[model samples]
Target: MPAHIGRPVINLGAHRVDTDALIEHIRTTYSDPDEHPRMGVWERIIRNAGVTQRYWTRPLAEATATTGVARRAETAFGDALDLAETAARRALDDAGLDPGDIDGIITSHTTSWTVPNLDVHLVERLGLRPTVARMPLTTLACAGGAHALVRALYFAQARPGARILVVVAETLSTIYHQAETTPQSMIYRALFGDSAGAVIVTGVTDENADGLGPGLLADDPFELVLPGSRDRYWGTIDDDGLHFESTRAAARAAADSLPYLTDWIGNRAVEWVVAHPGGPRIIDDVVAGVGLDPEKHGRHSHASLAENGNLGGAAVLDVLRRMHDDPPVSGDPGVLAAFGPGFNLAAIYGCWA
Candidate 1:
């Protein structure tokens, strides 16, 4: 009795900003005496990020405005809701189902802080039944999307014939702060983008459910959290907005987790790999860590990163969507992997039906 995950539907922000333009904008915005000297360094980092373009919920100019955090949070709140609704609706439609069919909802968001969470609002916006079970995750960050699916698998297994909707949305652009002159902030501002993605997971009694979706096998998923690695990547709330704290060691930490990853994967043949596009180095680490053939399985994750930049938890779903659109040979086994703030690595093995 495996749960099936529907094809994911992704919705990127309205504006697509060229990477070169973004670098130039960053230079102009931080042209103060104290920050002027580091413009060239920032430029180098931006180019090395391996992203040519990324979408933003609002125009770059508006996003980089000197507005206070209150205003930024306010704007992000509204935009997140709109994107969440769009992706969720599209995902439901893609599964050949309606809102009423969804028995549970799972949402993952890290870009903004809100009391009621996106799940509550999404249920209303999409006209779902009020009694639908809801679980909203705010802590997973980049790993949230894959983790959402893992959680959905658990829910589906617990209640047979359950239909679950998973939505992951991030407005990283809203967290860009011109006041922060640190290299971590600069890299985050240049590399991150805004996007939303949704998927439907249906629990079925039969393992060979016809065209139900990609089956998340009954096998247990894998997770690894490095001890005391919390400070390697995180965000802090200040008057301006959320400030990112990322260290060079973060990439090394990702690579270091390879042994644990290998142990969890065991002897499974991973024909396809869905990895979170943390950055060039992180992707490289994952490829090496998971022992994947770069020529064969690496393109999907790299393509997702190049096109959408890093959408945080929404990234893995984007990659999964691409695989669904083109699809691999039926019954090909695949693996989904992502890393987030807890210095956590989460992976799930599945097969296309």
Candidate 2:
């Protein structure tokens, strides 16, 4: 092994739309008085979220439209390839490594499908080594990104001197409900957007290793099981679009658990919190649960909320990218957390180096 364990994320790149354009797009496309009221509820919620921009895989119509099976299939397949390739290459470039140097690939996307999956497609398009190992995660929702990263770390631990490329491309926009108005459905619609991110991790490190930084803080992974919360947020294909349900109780459970986890990790206030930017209410509830100044975490939370809405598995990374780009200081500590299908929360603490 060269030097370090889990390499620190050194650079991040993303593409997104500003808040004003996103709000206008949502109002013009999805919300209607009959189906959705002009009470300015969503607008007010988003504005309070503190996000100024977000990104997606397609226009809002494509998300909730009733299209022929053949057309939907075609769109999903093609878009999956485009998203995977774009994100993978960007991460490779940021790490200053040629794609061929990626000894392994871990791809994560929950909202769509591809025949060979993005790993094989990326191997072919980017001309990676023919023997590059492939690991693809299609489920697990928002937790997929961190899961993939941790898996990469595990692989490195198994065999020293290996390099793994981890990529997450969850297109939440591809799964949408335009006409649903229940609290669950409304929360789902209000939260999700589409985006992708990738990171390069080397098993071995060096003082001069490109795109590599400090070691990862250690922590055991835990999943909080909230019984009967299975249906709190579930997605299914329908004529109107992909339908989602986000229950009030589920949101409360996620909020309630934050404090316990925070305290377990050794303190109440962290230098940074990378909580998933699910929606205004979810963030608000989590803020109250953690009892920290929302103003501190509010900017990244609201910024990710406003800009990308919620990018499912990619949401936490979107926030992390913001922190990586404009970090607070060299020794600041952070907690990266997100809630997912198990109605569970996942967290890892880190130091900025």
Candidate 3:
């Protein structure tokens, strides 16, 4: 097989809004301990998401030249772009590569949308090569980080020595609606957090210079199908903001999808499992579905949830960052996975360089 030719993870940069202050504000704002027991439940639920903090653009008031919480929805599109650019630049610096070296750029976000989109603005502001290819993925949910990585890997494989940037920005804070108590809305309130994680991957022949090993994708890999369950999750643009739908069936869907996932990991000694920390219940179902030890990734996943809440598309990247900064018990060959809309699950193989 030909060498895949690029380092999987040369470096990573993560930025977040002030977490402690945000937590305090949330606790203060939702001060009715009696009226909102769920609020208290969430204060505890957030601790398990494997995030310590997140970076966000200004609140809706600041993002928009307006007053009141309802007006904040209007500014979400703009703030997402602001956060993405800031994180992407930091990632380029982390990789010690100039923006001009970037031959491809992939941006992942689920919270907001813009007319020209983030890619166009980033290209101009970062001084990227004029010919740089851009891929913007939206509405993919938590699996987006892994999805972006897969896209970058393919680009590097086709163009040997090419550099690609993957930027994941999400602002769940901007989408929160206090009036709605739908299951989906409650899930968002319980899980979502604001954050961005960026990484630069470059095709490199030398193994030592690469901080991580290249991901060797096996040709003709088996596809594990979840049968595309719409019963799990859905989202749409509404007059006020995008409204999402999540069913109790989602947990059942995750549970039912496990055997197929386990078949994919058959016989592989997964040294580390990097999964998006959706929540304790959702993650537990994922672990059970994949037939893996819940204890293996429990600590990291819990830490992310506890500290960061849920960062939507950025959650898995946050997990990767924690692993990169404080690796899980050192070794080789870690299995990374994430779930997204369309009720999709993506897995990848990575090793320490």
Top candidate on lDDT is 1
Question: What is candidate 2's lDDT per residue for 1-353, written digit by digit as tens?
Answer: 33222322211123445556556755776555663575377666545545565455565544457674456655655665676678777777766789778788887776664567767777889889999999987776787766776677677657666778877766665554445445455345556666666777666545334545644332333345556668666656654444555566665767667666767677534666667777776676665555556767657766777756777777777777776656657666656677777676666655555
TM-score quality measure for candidate 2: 0.80
Candidates, ranked, lDDT: 1, 2, 3
Which 10 consecutive positions of candidate 2 have the poorest summed lDDT?
Answer: 3-12
**What TM-score should be assigned to candidate 3?**
0.79
Candidate 1, residues 282-339: lDDT per residue as tens digits? 8877876677776567687788888889999999898888877777777778788899
lDDT string, candidate 3, 140-246, tens digits: 76778778777766676677666778887776765555555444564565466666767776654455344534333221122233786876877766656665677
Whole-model Cα lDDT of every candidate shown, in order? 0.83, 0.63, 0.62
Instruction: List the candidate 1 regions with Cα displacement exceeding 4 Å.
Output: 32-34, 213-219
